[model samples]
Target chain A: MSVSANDNAAKVSVRGVLAKYSVLIAFAAIVIFFAIASPTFLTPANLFNVLVNNVVMLAIVALGLTIVISSGGIDLSVGVSVDMASMIFVMLLAVGYSGVVGVAGGLGAALIVGILNAIMITRLNISPFLATLGVLFIGQSTQQLATSGGQPIYLTSGYAADQFNAIARTALFGMPTPVIVLIVLVVAVHVLLHRSVFGRYVQAMGAQPGVAWYSGIRVPRELSMVHVLCALLAGVTGILLSATVKSYVPLSGNAFLLDAIGATFIGTTLSRERKPSVIGTLLGVLLLAIVKNGLLLVGWNFYWQQVGIGVLVFLVLAASFGLRRVAH
Target chain B: MSASVLHTEVAVSDEKQAAAKSAGRRFGALVVRLGAIAAFAAIMAYFVIFAPGFTSTFNLINVVEQSAILGVLAYGMTSVIIGGGSDVTEGGIDLSIAANMGLCAAVYATLLSMGYGDFLSVLAAIAVGMAVGALNALAVVGLGILPLLATLAVLNVAAGMELTLTQNTVVGASSPLLGVLVSGSFLGISALAWALIVFSAIMIVVVHRTSFGLRLYAVGGHPEAARAAGISVPFYVSFTYVLSGFCAAVASILTVSRLSASTPGSGELLLSVLAAALLGTVFSRRFVPTMGGTLLSVLFIGLLANGFQLLNVSSYWVNGVQGALILLVVAITSFARGSEGSR
Candidate 1:
């Protein structure tokens, strides 16, 4: 009996390790497969482009999502925040405003959305999911309305074009500006989430709101702050995205919503307790960025590439949870 | 002893508290029904008073015709919400249903254009829809992923498949059968509207008059209790998704027939479908989803949009107005519940 008990314990531990590290393993496998299959995949310039061009905005959005999920809520409106910012920023530039003022206008728009989300969720007792869904619908229509039926705004010629391009294009220490911004934001969010008092309270509230409230944690305030912080990150992403494209596509920010959610959930698998973390989200973003870049180089159609990413997300999640359930 | 006397007093107070709680719950239900009725009346009055041509019989028929597809989608949403377990709002949301409909429409249109008969195309479309339902069940019931996330992942897959099938272009089903089904009217109503009414009636009977329906409500109200009563909880949970897929399949067929074409934009109706279903809850006394209520809400939204268009409001603002109205209704409903609980 003692020997059997020891064997069962060992088996459970093995399953736990597999559940935790499966995504990492899959990430490495994908990288190797792409490197072998495509001649350009392993090139330094291509890889750098993937890091600089593909992952920066996604990484920022996922970082925000990581915090929101850690606080036991979701912000489906994050994409709208990005979209609204882009709309305002581009409209300002079209009217001949300076880039700095345009960016401030964009961030201000995102801030209002964040506050409205907090009011709905905390004050009105709405579920975060439904609240954000409402915001998403409203946001989409607002952009369409502002653009007079959803036309994209281009910065054809002005200081707006030069200054915006420089924001994303200029490199420091041999790295693109967006990559540098991503690194700085990642470190700041990592430290804030892992070491700050507010972060601890957010985690506690997520684990058990009733218990956290009884322990004197200000649950509502922390939850609202998390949403505000998330919106700010999305705002930054909007600014960078418009800068990179030199255009504002109405409702374009919606493309990132599902990917951000996917990356954050994938991040959850990295923790034994399934908590969200900055490093895990970074890894998730890298995996997605690489898959996208690699698939494009391999001549896959745009739609089929989406299909592949969806399958990847589903398989990783199923494998992890299925194995854990069997072991238990 | 003094302790026994004190225990008796405590029991008496508990009985009083329970009585008060039930009373508050009844009041809450009353509030929801009344609020919904008032809101519906207000919308009608606004349209009749402010918007010209809105009161005409022709426009009324047009509104109902426009709402037919939404009515079917809402019926599916209602069934899923009622049959799922606790956390109904989150657990019952099937984001892939609209995308599933798009894929079905794509498949049906493709088959029709390839010289296949109508019967084969319809069967193929439904089969594909059910196949997606099976996947959703595997992810949600079998693997225990959150319903919202699982359906969302499937949504992407379905949309991708649709894009690949259509080559990112609009395709039409231009056969005689589809044309007749869309254009032929019976008893002064179009075939599409008739289809919606029949589907809604069938769903109402299935959801309210069957043993399966009772079992579903039991599971959704409390999963452990249902399990203890020997019901297969996972089976019922997964069955709702299957039913939802069938509804989408049927809706897609009608939609493709009506429009004579299917495009990537077909998936954009998801938010409106969800809103209609949620708004339906306000018409219920217990805040539960019902097919009759869903049909009414769909009509309400369709008419509202028509009125706005007559008033020269941009069609883009329709979505915002719908969303804002839903938020207001939900707020009132939840506030009533909160007050009841506090009482």
Candidate 2:
């Protein structure tokens, strides 16, 4: 009888551990599978390429989304902010503006979207999901109007272009500039979300708004500030994206929207209370980026890669939640 | 005696103030309830005066016909939103509906291109939609995933499957049945418009008159109460998704019939569908989504698009205008309700 009881306890502990760390385990397993399946996957060059090219922009966007999700709101217009920034940045440079001016314009455009979202959510009493969705639609139309039926704006070989590209291309401390930017933003967000008073208030509000309100957290003002901060982070990504590609492709920023949402949600599995965290979001971005790159290297078609990613997301969440159910 | 008289005077004034406040609220509610219809009428007036060719019967019929597919899709979304109940984060949306429509169309076209019988292909396409819906239901109801994320996963998977099956190319279908669906008119109305009418009729009966719909509304409006009353909340919620899937399948058939081809990225109608369904809420004083409201909202959007084209006012402005209109309508609706509207 005692032996059986001991065995049951061991099983319970195993399930508990699995439930808590399923995302990390699945991520590791995917990495190992890719490394074994593709000879080029383990190389430093390929890994660096993944970090700099595929991961940084998505990481920045997901990090921003992480803030909104942490604040108990969803920002479907992250793509709108991203597109606005890139569009304004490219347009400014095309019109003989300097790189600094273009970057400021880009960030400013993104900030407008955030401000609009804040107003709708806080003042007008619109739900975050609906407000952001409305912004997304309006943003798309605005882009189309500006570009005359959604045409791409190419910035090929100019002083401003070269200067803009340097934001992404320049290396700092043996790391690419964008990657360095991503790391700094991640650390700042981590400190903001995890180690600061404001972060605590945000989390408290998210966890229980009624409680936070009674406790005097100044819910509406803080929520507005959170959205603005989130938009700024997405703007940084937009600038980086335009710099890397050297063009502003209308509606291209929307491609990151779904993936960023997926990554942030996947990252939530890493938290004990299932809150969004910066480190967790970064890891989630890394996992998705690696899978995307590995699948390409492994000769999977684009459609199949999407299927693979969807299945992987479902499985990771299922594993974590399902095991938690069993453990309870 | 003087003190008592002073207190009585204060109470009488408070009662009068309360009565006046309630009367004002009643007037606000009336305005909010009429907001959507008034906007529709106003926009129609503007187009009739400003846009040439907008008042033609042919153009009006064309707008209604164009609204058919979106109408059907919006009705399905309305049911899901209603089932989702009061919480925005709950199971109120099916983001994969557009993707499901694309995949179903692809399936139908691919099967016909492979020399399959028309009836068989249609059935197979519908089956695929049902399967996708079942998968979504299993993930959301059975496994307890957030409705948004679960539908999003299904969207990616469905879209990818569609792209894979079509090899990222358009697939054409040619058949007599499809021809009738696209061009055959009865009583001066297109068959597509007829389909919308039939679907709307069915939705009205199912959602407003049937026990199933009552249970669904119950589940959405108050899950705890519904559960206490012995309603299977999960079953009803799952059924909404399945119904949405079925609607998408029906819309796909019409889409293929009209275009004569299944193209990649037909899922771009997602935002429009969402907008129509969301806009439906403004028609109700309580801000509840209804099939009637959704059908009207779809027509409103269709008319706007048609008028914009006639006026040559840059078709790009339609989406922005639609977004702005939804915000304004919902804002007014919520504002009229005061503190209760904040949710």
Candidate 3:
């Protein structure tokens, strides 16, 4: 009987495997298609350049978003959180802080913001949606009031700091540091989510929180931890953004939140499962980035890559999950 | 749990015995929501005593003129929220609204400047805003995407288009006071104030005295129950957005009339409009959007903005205060108290 049950499980697993890989398969096809379309697209230089410039910070932000989403929560403030971090980082640099100190301070600020989001949701019991939205507003306001004049900060000297610049500039075998960082972080987070005890707790909480709690899980604490990690990742993105642009804008993160959320949700359709897959999210982000890249390469007249992302997210959602439950 | 069950039975018995009394109390609680307006009035009264030019016809007229567009947008938002959807879903923040209105103003002005007819240019602006709002609704309700995420995406799209087209400048108005009277009033009343009074009365009549208003409340209160009652969930959801778009269009026109030049990318004001709409919800004891509540909320915000300006407050302070006020309202209404619902 045990052998028979195992065999049944194996069959189910195999089906799951196929469903999960469909999105990756599409992604592989995209890379190959892009490679054929533009000779320069797959060259090591462009590959590394895009990875370093277009992708890494977003990947980190996406990772945080994934955790929140998996637990059935969301953070509309990630973009604003990143903006606040950039402002703080720039201000620190301007005030004569070392590169290490500035980056650390910026990330710490973001972490606090993240925790606040968690507190609002878990402690005060505000719906995650409304709470984060309020945070988003507060964050934008922070950027406006952080400086007396509400101007974007310039990290004049920090940009030239080799150590800081290395975030975007350093490469392993002609691959950028961001790509290396993304790979390492993804692999680590994947293991943390899938292979650890905490991982099991998270999934259980997401699938059924009350049941999980009755069965001996401290759900709120675990969820709060997830919230913190999201903010930390967004904060890191802020630092990376400054390194790439050599300056900071107040609202830079505003453009990334929805696109990352959309990409994350779209990625889930690939794995075709109840739970989000790290690998699937990576593929989704890649697909979205490439689509935007392709649009730019072909000189598409539509200026709202973000808007296209919003619409694409809708398509993905309709195909994967039905609209938020109706009365029935 | 057992004691509460007994209490529930007892409460039910008591409720049946005093239905009329209970309903009267409920109505009284609703009237209390009007206290916010009194609070605003008191604040304004203080300003009148302390701040210079606080009661001047010119400044009073300007305040009415300034709030007209925001008031209109709040009306659209209240409709959506009454149906239980959050306004922020359609990029419903004041900032987005202001930015969109600004862009429309710029688009109309530029076209008119380029020899396009006023009517044609105005139509184009309306079309653009409606299309954007519809796209937002379809993505969220039809496509199963999150509202906030979808709307912000449109926000970017709108922003990008505005920048590309306007090169970031004001458009539309060639006159110093083309539609200023739309905001001005007669017989010691600002026209804009009068417009709101009329709008609120009409909307109140539509929502409270019509089948549509009843359906809207039912939809918001319980979607499954509403569906069971045979309401078209998706249609109403989409229709609300279309209405919202229509409001944005009218508001944009009024905004252009006020600016005499459309400031490109002014839709960012949607954030404030959204806040006002949400605040209006709390003012109704029912926690549903009432036309009177929305109008009052607009007036409240308009008064606050006017008071700040009169008192020499900074714009940054204005934003912080605005954000704080919204957060407070969200907090107050977040859980809804233990009081039995009218349903």
Candidate 4:
């Protein structure tokens, strides 16, 4: 009986490890598959282009979402919040602020939106769904109607501050600034999520808030911090996006909503028991970037790309969890 | 004797005041809901009387026909919400409905134009639609992913499939069904309105009569409790989505008949339809997606849209206005829902 029990325990441990590793394996597979399908996919220039072009700010927003999802919550309003950031950033620059202030102002507006989300989610105990939905309406409409009577606003003057433009177009040590920014964010989040005691508390709070409460953690305040950080990251995402596109559009953030959620959920399934992890989320985002970059390079039909992403999200998540019984 | 009589009269008047207060609260809520409906009616009436051709048979038919798609989609969304899940996955629904219409139009138009039977095309579209709905159900139920996220992914896939199949847009079926579906009026009402009325009637009955309806409300109200009580939450959730899928297919048929082209961008209509469905919940008590409430929502939006054309203003204003309306409704409804939870 004792021998059998020991064998069972070892089997469970191995299974746990496999479930976690599958997420990374999946990312690796996609990267390799795409590289073979399209030689340019693996090219340094193309990879850099994909990073700098498609997913600078989104990576930041995804990082924030990872934090929120860790707390067992979700945010649909990020798209709108991110969109609002672009408008707020542009409007500030148009008002003739310095580049530093423009960036600050953009981040500041996102923080306010985030705080509102936290309040609605906390004080009112509203589900993140309803709360974010409320903001989605307000944010999208605000973006669309922010200018004079539903007209689109463009910044054709002064390059919206030269330094800001450089952030998007310029590279850090031969790497695109956005990619560099994404790396910095990933490192910062990794440290914050893993090394910080506060991070552990968030996990505890999500997995079992009651127990965390008994352990003397201030749940409300912790949740507020998490939300604020999320919004701030979203603000940064908006700034990056605006710089890259060289203008702000109301629909700028619309595409990210599903992708972010998909990435996060897919991220959760990556590391352990198909649960949330910092490393897993990063890998998931990378995997998606590869697929997107590869598809664009090869000129795959737009619809097929969407179908592939959908199938991948479902398949990887299922596979990640399915491997939970594996002994090795 | 006089003092006793005075005391009795005072007590009677106090009781009457208490009764009046209670009635006033009830009346206030009713008035608020009705006022929203009335405001929409007033707007429509203003257009009908003031704008040329606003009340003409052609324009009237246009309004009803436009509303049918929104109403059906909204109604479909309501069924899922009633089960306590937001269809938030991609575009948050079985968006293949529009695609279904497009697909049907393609299959039918090709066959008809090529001398194949029109009936086969229609059947093909519907069969594919039902299959699409079932696919959504299978994915959502089988996977423990959130309903909103699950359906959202499916929407993307379906949209992709539709695009690939049609290579973009397709010509509508050769024959228009407007004459048959909407040209024949009953009881002094337009046929489109009558068609909508019949659809709504069936929806209400389906929600109330069968065990399916009961299962839906139960699952939405409290999934764990319902599950513990031996209800199959997954089955109900999947079933409602599948049913909504069929509704979308039917709506697609209607739209193809009216427009003569299966538009690529019709996929986005789900968002507007959902907004209306959510608005209907506000008119309803406690997230109740009542047929009357949904129809009222349709009327409200229809009035606004039709009124816009009459005023000769750009239709873009309607999006901003609709967005505002949605925000306002949710803010108000949530405040109401929140108060109960706060207590």
Candidate 5:
């Protein structure tokens, strides 16, 4: 009986160790697979492009979603904020407005959306899922009305294109502007979430609203702040996207919602306590970005690329959570 | 004698106040139920009065047929939500139903184009759907993945498969079988509509009459209690997804037959399906998903869309209007439901 008990304990410990590092191992394995499969996979130029171009926007949006999810709220309207920012930015530029004014206008519109989201959740007491869903619907429709049935707005003139593109194109210290923006936001959010009283309060409310309320956390106010922060970050993404494309395409921002959600959840696997973290979210973004870039180079069709990512996400999550269950 | 009379008067006043409050509560509940139906009726009446050609028999028939697809989905969604209860668990909701339908339709179309027989194609499509459902069950019930995330992952995977199959191009069946099946009518009703009616009947009986049906509420209401009573919690939860799978398969088949073509965009039906399902709850006393309520909600949306089209409303505003309608209904329901809880 003593021997069997020792064996059981050892088995449990092994399971726990495996669950903890499964996602990290999977990430490393995928990277190795790409390095071996493609000669250019590890090249500095390609890697830089992945960081500066492909992954930056998604990473920023995913980071915002991480905050909301960490606070136990889901914002389906994040994409809408992004789209709204894009719409407002492009429209202002089309009217020959200065770039700074355009940026301010876009951000202001996004802030309005954020504030509205807070009201719906805090004052109305709607569940985050339903409330954001309602916001998503309203936002999508509002864009439709503004754009007159989903027409694309282009900055065709040289001045407009150049002026708008500067936001995305300008480099500081040998890095793209968006990449720099990403770094700044990451640091800010990390500090806000991990090293501050507000962050603790947000997590507390999310962990248990009733308990937090009783403990004097002012649950509604903290929760509302999380949504606002998320929306503002999403706004940043929208502006960057507009700068990249030089156009505002209706519903173009919707893709970020799913990808951000996927990344955030994958990031959770990296958390020691299964909480969302900035580093974990960045790793999640890197994982997705690598898969996307690697698969394209490996000659997979775009549609099949999504399949690869989906299957990979499921496998990684399944392996991690499945082992944790066994350990418990 | 005067002191006794004064005591009796005070007691009578207190009783009267309590009776008044009870009546007010009942009145409020009645208003909630009637309010939704009234709104729906009011909209329909407005359309009939203002839109000159709206009440034509031909238009009405078109509306019913068009609504058949949503009705079928609403039926499945209602069942899933009912089984999930108030707190949807790891496998509570099926976000992949639309994607599942798309994939099934793509597979059916591909097989038919390859000269496969109708029976084989139909069976294969349903098998694929059921297999997807089983995968969802495995993820949520067996593996403990959250229902929302699991189904969402499945959705992406299914969509990817569909895009791969069609190569991002629309796939059509050259066979005349689908055309006939779709276009063929029964006693002035389309076969698709007939199929919907049959499916609804089967669902009503299954949900309301079967032991499996009765166990769903018990499991949803309190899983621990149900388990203590010897109920297999996973079985009922997983079964609802299976039923949903069957429904998606049927919806796919109907769409394939009607369009004679399948596209990746067919997966876009998820939102409308969910909206209609949620709207159904507002018509119920307990705000639970019910079959009759779902059917009515489907009709209401159908009417709204038809009216919009007749009025020459810009298609751009359609989605916004739809979303607004859902938000409004959901808000009202939540308000009523909240009061119910407080009382």
Candidate 6:
């Protein structure tokens, strides 16, 4: 009888461990699989390329998404913020504005979207999803109007262009500028979300808005501030993206929206409470970046790479959630 | 006797106050329900007065024909929205609908190119859509993933599949059925418009006049209560998704027929479809999604786009106008509903 009891305890412990770390295990397994399949996958230079060239902008965007999602709101117009900022920034540079001025214009455009979102959600009492979606549509049309029917603005030459390019291309202490920027953002968001009293209030609101209100948390104010911060982060990514490409293509920022949402939600699985977290989101971005890079190295075409990513996302979430169900 | 008289007088005054409050609430509800229709009427009036060719038979028919495919898609979305509840965070949306339509179009074209009969190809394409819906159901219901994330992943998969099959090129097909679907007309209306009407009628019966419809709504409104009532909540939810997939297939057929080709990247219709379905909510007395409301909303959007084009307005302005109009209508309705803004 004792032997059987001991065996049952061992089985329970094994299941608990699996449930707790399924996502991490899946990520590791994929890494090892890629390392075996492609010899260049584990190279330091390739890793650096993945971190700097492939995912810096995505990391920044997903981190911002993590913040809004943790505060019980969704920002479907994050792409709008990115596109607006990139549009304004490039337009300024093409018109002979200095890089600093261009950056300010870009951030201001992004902040406008955030402020609009806040007003619609708080003052007008619109749901976060609908309000942001409306903003996204309006922002798209605004871009089209500004560019006279969706023309791409290229900044190939000039002093402002050089300054803009330096944001992504230049390196300090053997690290790319964009990578350093991403690191700084990750740390800042982590501290803001996990180490501050405001963070606690935001989380409380997210867990239960009614309860948070009853506890004297200013839900509306914090919610507005959260959206503003989220948009600013996306604006930073927009600037980086413009620097990397040396151009602002209309609606290009939408390419990152779905992926960032996917990564942030995937990051939620990393927490025991299934809440969004900065470090987890960073890791999620890394996983996606690695998968994309590895698929390219393995000779899969772009379309197939998308299929791979979709399947991977579903599988990871399923395994983690399924295991947790069993554990309970 | 004097004390009893005084008590009766107080009771009469209290009853009068209660009646006044109820009357005010009813007025507020009526205003909220009629807001979208009022906007629709106002916009139609403006277009008729200002836009050239706004009342021409050709443009009017054109608008209805163009709205047909979207109308069908919106009907499916309405069912899903009703089945999943009115909450945005709930699993009531299918982001993969447009992508599924694109993929089904690709499948139909590929099958035709491979020398399959048109009827057989159409059936196979629809089956693929149903399969996609089932996959979404498995992920969302069985695996317990959030509906938003699950559908988003499926959207990627469907789009990727479409791109892979078509190889980023348009796949054209020719058949008598396809030609008729595009150019054929009946009773001074296009065949596509007829399809829209037929589907709407069918959906009205299925969603409003049937027990299945009631159960689906019950499942969405309160899953726990539904389960307690032995309504098979999972089955209803899964069926709604499958129904949405089927609608996408039908829309795909119309799309492929109209263009005579299945184009890559046809998933861009997602936003317009979502807008139409959400706009439909304002037409409902209880602010829930309804079939009639979806059809009307689809026509309204079509009319707006048509009028803007006729007025020599830049196409870019249409999107902004649509967004602003939706925000305004939704805001009025939400305000009229008082503090229940989260819905």
Cα misplacement distance, residue B280 of candidate 3 (Å): 2.7
Poorest stretch of ten by lDDT in candidate 6 chain A: A319-328
How close to the true structure is residue B217 of candidate 4, measured as C-alpha lDDT? 83
Give the per-residue lDDT of model 6 (tens digit) for B1-343: 9999999998898789767766766687787776667778888999999998899998988898899888978887888888888777655888899999999999998999889988999999899999999988888788777788888889988998998898999999877778888889899888888888889999999998999988988998899999999999888989988999999999999999888999987787888888899988888887788898888889998999999998889999988988887788778877776634322
Error of 1 at A45 (Å): 1.1
lDDT of 3 by residue, A130-244 (tens): 6787787777767777766467666545344554576667778766676777888899779977788878888887777778889898888988898888898889888888877
lDDT of 3 at B86: 49
Query: How well is each residue in B6-120 modelled by candidate 4, as lDDT tens digits?
Result: 9999989877876775565556556556655565567777887888788787677677767987887677777767765443332234434444444444554455556555466
* Of 1 and 5, the candidate ranking higher by TM-score: 1
Model 6 clash pairs?
none
Candidate 1 stretches greater than 4 Å from native: A1-9, B1-25, B86-90
Residues A253-300, candidate 2, lDDT per residue (tens digit)?
889988998899888888668888998888889989999999999999
List ranges where model 3 is wrong by over 4 Å. A1-37, A158-160, A172-175, A194-216, A271-277, A301-328, B1-50, B55-58, B84-107, B136-164, B167-169, B175-197, B335-343
In candidate 6, which residue ranges exceed 4 Å CA deviation? A1-13, B1-22, B339-343
TM-score of each: 0.95, 0.95, 0.81, 0.81, 0.94, 0.95
> What are the chain A TM-scores for all the models, listed individually?
0.96, 0.97, 0.85, 0.89, 0.97, 0.96
TM-score of candidate 6's A chain against the true A chain: 0.96
- lDDT by residue (tens digit), candidate 5, A1-328: 9999999999998988888888789999999999999999999999998897678999989988989988888888899999998899899999989889999989888888788889888877666776787788889889989987789998866888988768888899988888999999999999999889998997887677778989998888898899888988999999999998889998888889888888888888875577888888888888989999999988898999988988888787888788888889
Top lDDT: which candidate number? 2
- Each prediction's number of clashing residue pairs: 0, 0, 31, 7, 1, 0
Q: How close is candidate 4 to the true structure, as a TM-score?
A: 0.81
> Which stretches of candidate 2 lie above 4 Å from their native place?
A1-13, B1-26, B341-343
What is every candidate's C-alpha DockQ against the true complex, given to 2 decimals? 0.62, 0.68, 0.30, 0.30, 0.56, 0.70
> Model 6: how far is A318 from its true place, Å?
1.5
Residue B317 local lDDT, model 3: 66
Question: Candidate 2 — what's its lDDT?
Answer: 0.88
Question: Judged by DockQ cut-offs, is candidate 5 incorrect, acceptable, medium or high?
Answer: medium
